[model samples]
Target chain A: MKLFQKMGAALPSAKKLVSGLLDESQPPVEEDQGGFGPPGGVLWTTPLDVLSDRPKAGLPTQSAINAPLPEPAPALPPDSPDRSEALERTGLLCTDIEATSEIGGFIGACLVDSGSGLVLAETGDGRIDMEAAAALNTQIVRAEHEVIEVLDLDDHIEDILITMGKQLHFIRPLEKSPGVFLYVALDKKQANLGMARMQVGRIESTLKM
Target chain B: MSTDIAATTEIAGFIGACLVDSESGLMLASEGGGKIDMEAAAALNTQVVKANLQAIETLGLNDGIEDVLITMGKQLHMIRPLEKAPGVFLYVALDKKQANLGMARMQVKKIEGGLSL
Candidate 1:
């Protein structure tokens, strides 16, 4: 009996539910507004649409977009010898001396201060003592100066060459920098003195100070 | 004995040349110096030779000097100690523009060989 009574009450609720769905499917029609419907006719709005209505102060202007971008720093060539960091401390570049190591029979090379006998920069094959050579060669420079004074040879020392039984030593004072010299030791058998001197002169010209 | 250094005139771009005694810095024979004072050069070059010798000895190179060459801005100077004579040396100067260093060295070496003193 109780089950029959509950069935009777549930049937009316089911009928009411069907009528609600039918009403939703037959919604009242309105005049077509073409594809360009009313502005607020959208069911839901996107974040872009919401923000688009606001001020554009933070956005880039048309002129800003058309302007050229800043250029990247210019790159150095692969074989360029100017090493800026190493060159900063002293005007004498080690890369310049390293270029001298490319000579045919280069035993060693150094840049020396003729006044104080200091080895500013050097590169070598360990066959020669650059420090002692720098100091001794300073004396040679000084002696040459004395000779110049005694002879009244109104000139400066360009270079001094020492030819030994098996070796050749070259000392060239930088024309731009006073009291600074480039010293190179080479094997006599493998080096051409003329070419070596020419190359050394070329390298000396590139030195700034 | 002094050599006939007059033979050195044949060298190309020859400016001046002399044979100097390394001890007293005196020229024994000389040839072809227009504006250059050969006497002063010979006397001054002797010190260069001595200093080179001292440098060689101090470095303990255990070898004798073959030659000492000074390359000046306008000139090339060569100081070669004679093999036959212990205390005598040959000094020659050349104009850098016209002189060939290798040829000059060879000619100078040959002249040094013919020198008796």
Candidate 2:
């Protein structure tokens, strides 16, 4: 089918980026294993208690890409707030990449929650169905944990790139804690997969939670 | 996409009217979708999406589905299932004139992986 062909075309480039990720010097298998295992499985706690523990985590008190207010202090905070910030960061990240429209359609993008099928973040046009979209993408964070395990591929799937038609879809999973993965979606139509992989790669390096 | 919410807003806004993440009940990006309760709409639609995925698994059709659509007399519900993540879905509502159904569905399918989610 046409879709398979596009996915085939983009695979190699995505594979190359994975090979060249930030911690690539180690080994492909261990690339996404930075803070392996959640210290406390903190990403899903309720908002109230999570907010109370903010100061301890070293993250901004109040956040959002469009928050009008100055960024608050950064201390070791709790989980939910950190997750909000992560989601907010993802929104800001796409702003920076600046994918233009006039060019053509994007590849594919998704923000998948590996743990409970929760899409923490995502951005893409209209081609794929959201119902099928989120369930299909298996790239980032905790979502791919099982895939990696079952497939016998020991590496952590920081990002998985698949090309369809002329576009490329980049699935980058974020490690919020042990159990939660912040999913990031990207469109190859307006995105340069090479640069996109690297751009998101940098964001991962500076993550706080 | 969370990355370019503003751009997505301006762009998607120009197209259909609004976009919202069906799960987690958040507006990841939106262009236009009339006076619909993006949150409630997303929540209710979860059933439609869930059934399809379950069907795929039950039928052993693991070929991977990209997007699906539900058309009503008044509106069209565009559902895109991300190929990367397993259970999340992007729900977009369009006011017929605001978008070209065929193109919007195609565009949503095409723009899946610019964000790293």
Candidate 3:
């Protein structure tokens, strides 16, 4: 008798799955209908009932909503140093120009942006107008480049030396830092050209971009 | 004159050389210019010479220029005015890697001594 009861319970769904319109007495699958509520019939059922029965994917559950908030974003790095100060330390270009002053017979030294003809940094006595020199020297550099272009000299300028009666003006375009140059004015009598060139090259190597 | 200028090629690391009349900014002779336009260089280098002279006068340095040296990443350029011939100058370009600046200077001086024009 129990086997007959089990077969009776399974017969309707088996017939419904086999033939879509075979069962007129049974209504469509629904939550309250109980037609495909559990066990074997649940396999052929729509996803609506399954999703409502359990939590939807990716949404917060009751426990997740009740749990403590995530430690307040890790507390903003206690005593974060001023950004400009850090930048200043990282960019040693200005301070590096200062080292040029130690060169023998140094009258003035300035770092110029070749593209804009602006003085990025300057140090030395007030004998030379650093701003003017920066702008004018930019022209000199451009002229040299033009000459190179016209001459088809497949090369770049390392440095230019203007040996005056009393002073020697040295201009070096930084190899690592393109579009920027170092200008150092030295007393011709006191400064050794070879040594000064070596020193400038060393400083250029040490420059942190 | 071109043959006289060609003597500069004997210098170590010699690239190109020319003799220019600074007043006219024209080349009297040129040799081994490679791809370089020696004519333009002659004219432009004259400007450099003139500028240095003007700078000396303005500063009241009362000193005559020995030479103007342009050191490049790949090449070295020396502009020396002829003592015997006023308004004429010698310009030479050399490979920086192989050039001995002192020796190159001496060679330029020697060549200048022999060059009469």
Candidate 4:
């Protein structure tokens, strides 16, 4: 009689469960597949005990996002000569000549090609005609060369100085770059010849082709 | 005068000396000789002088050229325009090791003062 009473009580609960499973309106319980959740599901849906967790669709794991980025390369020095900017080099040379205080009474200056009498670069006030000066000075240099050849002096010309009552002119031929020279003009009263010569030498040493 | 040329020739290490008419590129008188051809040197130096004069005129500095000195490794060339004769010049070349620049300049100036033409 007791066994029959227990069966009768369990039969009602079993019937309710069966009805709930068969109902079409009720949602099915989703099984967690070893932490490999369904598409578009949360990444951490798997429990810690799951051993075969697979990557979720279209998403990176936490480790990749936290990885450090590669470092940037080192920078170059500002005034390194290895840099290959030709125009900048010429511009800086002119700036250096303009800023040097040792070349007093600085009326004007130019770099000239001795062969063709062409002005490669020039900087100065409008009072001085650098083009004419370059062309004429080229003739002077050529004449000197001829004299040297005729005399067979077995020497090289370092520099030439033309002194006038009111002005002084200098022409220094470049030893490394033949057929080129530096021409500078200054006022006699304001310039120191020795200092100007030294400054010109320094400038020539640093000039690039 | 001939005596002035003699004095210029007597300077130590004097390789050559010439009186040039820079306006015409002519050598009026020449003394001493080594490897340099005085005639050619006179004509070439005249071109240098003319170029200098033109440069000064173009710049409009209203200045007269007094002298031009060319420094070389083994030699020194000096070109001085005659004060009395505006178009004339004295050209001299000397060995750098044997010549004293100050003394050479003084002697050249003295010769110029005594020169007749």
Please, what are the lDDT tens digits per residue for candidate 1 over residues A158-181? 989888888888899998885799
Give the per-residue Cα lDDT of candidate 1 at A124: 96
lDDT: worst 10-residue window of model 3 chain B: B52-61
Ranking by DockQ: 4, 1, 3, 2
Give the Cα error of residue B35 in candidate 3, in Å. Answer: 2.7
Candidate 1 colliding pairs, count = 0
lDDT of 3 at A96: 57
Residue range with the least summed lDDT across 10 consecutive positions in model 1 chain A: A39-48
Listed in order, the DockQ scores are 0.36, 0.02, 0.33, 0.53
Candidate 1 — which pairs collide? none
Highest lDDT: give the candidate number: 1
Q: What would the per-residue lDDT of candidate 2 be over residues A62-84, giving only the tens digit for each residue?
A: 43223343222233334545434
Residue B98, candidate 2: how far off, in angstroms? 4.2
Task: Please compute the TM-score of chain B alone for each predicted structure, in the order given.
Answer: 0.95, 0.70, 0.93, 0.92
Q: DockQ winner among the candidates?
A: 4
Per-model CA lDDT versus the true structure: 0.74, 0.42, 0.72, 0.72
Locate the minimum summed-lDDT window of 10 residues in model 4 chain A. Answer: A39-48
DockQ of 4: 0.53
Segments of candidate 4 deviating more than 4 angstroms: A1-84, A87-96, A99-101, B1-3, B10-12
User: What is the TM-score of chain A, computed separately for every candidate?
Assistant: 0.56, 0.39, 0.58, 0.54
**lDDT comparison, 2 vs 4, better candidate:** 4
